[model samples]
Target: MSADTPYREELAHALRVVHAASVLTKSVLRSLKNSVSAETKADDSPVTIADFAAQALIISALHAVYPADAFLGEESADQLRKNEGLAERVWQLVQQAQFSDVQQRENAHARLVFPATKEEMLDVIDRGTNAQLKGRVWVMDPVDGTATFMTGNQYAVCLCLLVDGVQQVTAIGCPNLRVNPQNPVNVKVHEELVDESGFGVILSAIRGEGTSVRTMLSDGLGEPCKIEVRSSTGGKEIKDLDLIESALGSTSLSQAEHKAVAEEVGAKWPGTVIWSQQMKYIALTLGATDVMLRLPLDKARYTHVWDHAGGQLLFQEVGGIIQDIDGGSIDFSHGRRILGDNNYGMIATQPGVFEKVNEAVKAVLARRT
Candidate 1:
């Protein structure tokens, strides 16, 4: 009998595409500089040229190999069609985009194809608007933190593959994240870290195979190094654990509510607040933070699948755990939104700490109700 190969090709392709997308975004940031502008989406979130261009580039590159796979991404071409100027800007960026590393471009150019025209670029961006939840689907957040990106801080290019609604592969590129975790970059610090040689990381994971990381380079990805969460906090109590949460107030619990949870858990209040959700997952995977919590201000609102899909798998593969407030598995089969009876806020932490953290999260959230 032959052995089963699970998402091997898909994982490789995803890593390559995500690295390319990160390059494209960093280029946009460098070129635009102070001139960067964003259009407000219907949800009132900001969308920039980087977001549109990255989405187009990733979807097109992935589709080149898996033409039959469906895509669900954060950006669509609907706005592009309405505003010709914005559309033109995104198209130009897409055309000029290439792998930052010369060696990577040379190696990937043969297999990955960029959109040939502005029209095709828009179409390629729209192709990711697939709403179906079945079969093989790729979920992407071209630029996970537009606000953070604009500030010249940290952001991520997130990509994941799901088959039958189960996460199979995840690849995320954090362009501004310090390649060396030992000298961790503080999100609160506005000054960007300078590593002229190369200064980013791409983390990837395939189902049951565990997680690995490689430095983002001007030539290609660095050698893969397997990673896992910090060993069980051991004697550390919940209060002693290092925690991370959202820097943005919109998607996370209120300041007072957050404080209560931290106090309840015995951790420091207002524990690290990084703007991007996926980046928080990466932080946990790298053992930068021991716990992450996201208690929605509004329980009825569903979280976009793209926001958490990629990060969830990467963290879990590294011995981390993620569950809704009620401790149920997150349901990704509900198409774009993670909807179900138990769908509530999120709690991601190291393996041994989930139970205690989840209990504290529920206790704090329950008081509000």
Candidate 2:
């Protein structure tokens, strides 16, 4: 179909699908997200049961709904074979009849053998690693923030419907993290949580149209709450040109040739350090923050599509912009959604000011070397 197709109905449905799966993720994440214990992947990044369960939930649910649609997720064949004495542990978990929460189910993920062997699980997770993205492909990051999720912070069930590399529909399920992370009731539906104040946030955007937020639910998603960019007048307002950045995630930017760019130009405003994931974009698009920067330790080293796709759509639809250090849009065309493909070190801001932002960044880069 063409860009922003009228015939494209799958995006909205997919949004609901992820929200359904997010319910499992939220419950499971809440239980295990607080676990300080973790495992490091070959890439030296932290991964936990939350990531595995989230992937399993998404893949299983997607297959049930649309068995024909191809899927691509992060955990793959390499992971299944790494640990020893893990097979029996997996079988024990899988053989159990009921799952109390997502964590329990995930702890037993090795048991839920699809074809045979743990590598099959990884293959399922890697279904989209090198996906033929030119047609209708479903891109997913079962858990967008592995580290954040491990710390009981922010993370997401990040998924989007990309037709020919253009994002048509975007869905981000930040179950525990707030739309206003500080205020859970920003727009979450009070179905399962039972607390009116603990509303879950769902940010959705239809390309070329606009973005909105509402209660995340399985039965029916509530009405859309329209969003727009609020200006940071260079005064003392937190909402002005200030940004939401993490000292850890910003490591690469600090070592970059232009390390002092943001704090130098934008007056280094106060920020709340929520874990990174789709929620950061939700916060940015929903007026929680004006600018959001991802200055990784190695600007060129670590980056992924699952991290930015949902946020990019939300910010763009809500009148903001996201791009690389050089100001070009991040590419999601690589079906596998790997690093070194598109924009890594990213800067997101309002649409009109990106030109100025780009210049400021370039100026800083030039001064360094």
Candidate 3:
């Protein structure tokens, strides 16, 4: 680590913790291959052992290092406390969880402390309930795409450091993502899910320091390489740019709106639909697609900060831009959810195309009224 690096310690800790969480989640997913079981949250979203265990593992590791920092995570230990069997299952996963590579385990710099007992696991998981949005706070989504994880597809282990509500550092580990940018992601989903060899990638960014990627190895992360979005659209028209959208089925309303915006912008319809928001951001950073849009189903819907916080920083550091659908900057200061004036949604694009895309989004969405 260089002395001049911004958030050097924080970034390194995030990378290591996210890597451990990825390993834990991958194991849980493999087990699900035999039998799938999950609990439904009040929001109607599914929660699995992977989600709870990963959250516990990450928050505990982070708490060991930065005791003073607050945390806002997507999962709570409430359900675990209510169900003893569920808590035991989660504890088992947390107890056995560790960095898979011998080098990572033995390396003093990368090793992490795990919870010793079930009670400690539940306590660590509850530590993430801190709601204080100010000061040094860590935001995490242990399993950003739990649904995708259940289906044996793409998901991410995400963590971000926020200082006074500003994203300072971000780390996301995609266990099933293909490390090779040249290869198509759709064809090799199953192979990447089942095989750990050269299958994973972790992306991290420090505020103002740009973004970098490393191949996830059993031993540890490979060499870091700087990454940025594609230079320009190569003189392509607005309609010609490739677009990516959410893969979750609940986004049908947004999907329908996306088609209208795509038609209005002259971009292609039925843009690439990936499993998670972070993965969609990854697609943009990797040049897998040119743009991504998330139009709220209605004015009442609010996008969670955890879903976009880390990925947003990664995209911006790589020369991409993100904004609310109405063309304002996406605000993270509102605590858990991104509360804008309206539920127009979000737009992410290559550097030069945000304005054009936002304009089309507004134009198309305006007609819905």
* Higher-lDDT candidate of 2 and 3: 3
TM-scores, all models, native as reference: 0.90, 0.75, 0.90
Residue-level lDDT tens digits of model 1 in 118-159: 999999999889898699999999999888788777788999
RMSD in Å for all candidates? 3.2, 6.5, 3.0
- TM-score of model 2 relative to the true fold? 0.75
lDDT of 2 at 38: 56
- The deviation in Å at residue 284 for candidate 1 is 1.1
Looking at model 1, residue 328 earns an lDDT score of: 83
Scored by lDDT, model 1 comes in at 0.78
Give me candidate 3's TM-score against the actual structure: 0.90
- The TM-score, computed over Cα atoms with residue i paired to residue i, of candidate 1 is 0.90
Error of 1 at 213 (Å): 0.6
* Whole-model lDDT values for every prediction: 0.78, 0.58, 0.78
Ranking by TM-score: 3, 1, 2
Clashes of each: 2, 10, 1
Stretches of candidate 2 exceeding 4 Å from the true structure: 1-8, 81-123, 179-199, 217-221, 228-240, 248-250, 255-259, 269-272, 294-302, 335-344
